[model samples]
Target: DAGVTQSPTHLIKTRGQQVTLRCSPKSGHDTVSWYQQALGQGPQFIFQYYEEEERQRGNFPDRFSGHQFPNYSSELNVNALLLGDSALYLCASSQMLAGGDEQYFGPGTRLTVT
Candidate 1:
């Protein structure tokens, strides 16, 4: 019955550190996707998970990783963070329907790398 949810609404970290963000998918949804939105730019797809497996990935480096849980929740991890990595991280959930997949987005986690 819940929509997508993300934790630690905001975060601050120093360069070269690591951070992990968490998300819970909406009820009846089976897919989770992550996106990064930099200032003055549109969101960029980070990766997607379906059936607890990574289904798609974007142009980010290996420093970006994610995991999808059996319960359809997810986590996004960034390692060796850089100042440029600072951005708003969003989590979206979707489910396949007769029409198409309908996606719902969560309030993003704002990450600031110092």
Candidate 2:
């Protein structure tokens, strides 16, 4: 009965590096969404997953990728990290059938790319 959770609360990487952040959805949630929040800015949608398929994506480039597993857990992968990639990566869970109106958020993973 654990709620949404994310791992490696903080991470540091250099430019051109790659990193993967993981998330587990709350019980009963079938959809997972990823967002990136820059300092003093609102979270920007990265993508969403339902039934292990990427349902939607934002304006980010292909360097940003992700996957959803059968158990509803998800991962966000970013490649060729740039300094601009530094941000707090947030993960949220919701029931796709509920119109995803209510989301349970996980403590974000802070990523810093030098």
Candidate 3:
């Protein structure tokens, strides 16, 4: 019954550096999605992974990338980070069904770029 979990609850980095975030999906979940949320804004989709493949992506730049493991866990990677990249990185998990799919989000990793 464990829920989605993220690592390094808080991270601070200098501009132009790279960072990687980790996520473990909830039990019985098969799909994983990544989102970015600014301080006062709602979560914006980064990308989604299912069957170890990227199923969908958002309007993010090429610097954003991700991977889904066979166990349904996932990792989000950002390269050439910029100051504007500071935000909360959220990981959500859900079982993709024909209908009635409910997604549960993780606590989120706070990223600060200087």
Candidate 4:
């Protein structure tokens, strides 16, 4: 089965433009999480989606939002992008249990805001 898939392997935007990235979780998976990784930094959890609802979120601004579909696919939307927002946006997929670990991550969508 497909592990996870992300669109536009790379993306570029200006300081104030918006961008939307897509992700498809692995087969049989019900949870999708978004992460941001800057250069020389570890992935920071952005938010998590399960059962078509946002279950958990990280310490990101309101500009970062996401949605999950019934089919387990997801989308990450960033509004009023800033240069600081430029990072490797990663999409991770995992099962929803009482407490689970080890999420499968996609290559990532590299976003650069000039």
- Local accuracy of candidate 2 as per-residue lDDT tens digits, 13-56: 99999999999999999999999999999999999999999999
Which candidate gets the maximum lDDT versus the true structure?
2
As for lDDT, the candidate ahead, 1 or 2, is: 2
Kindly list the per-residue Cα lDDT of model 1 for residues 41-83, writing each as its tens digit. 9999999998889989999999999998889899999999999
Higher-ranked by lDDT: 2 or 3: 2
- The lDDT per prediction is 0.92, 0.97, 0.94, 0.92
Q: C-alpha displacement of 35 in model 1, angstroms? A: 0.2
lDDT per residue as tens, model 4, 1-114: 788999989998999998999999988788999999999999999999999999899999999988888899999999999999989999999888735487889999999999
For model 2, the superposed segments whose C-alpha errors exceed 4 Å read none
TM-score of each: 0.95, 0.98, 0.96, 0.96
In model 4, state the lDDT of residue 104.
Answer: 88
Lowest lDDT 10-mer window, candidate 2? 96-105
User: Which one wins on TM-score?
Assistant: 2
Which consecutive 10 residues in model 4 have the weakest lDDT in total? 94-103
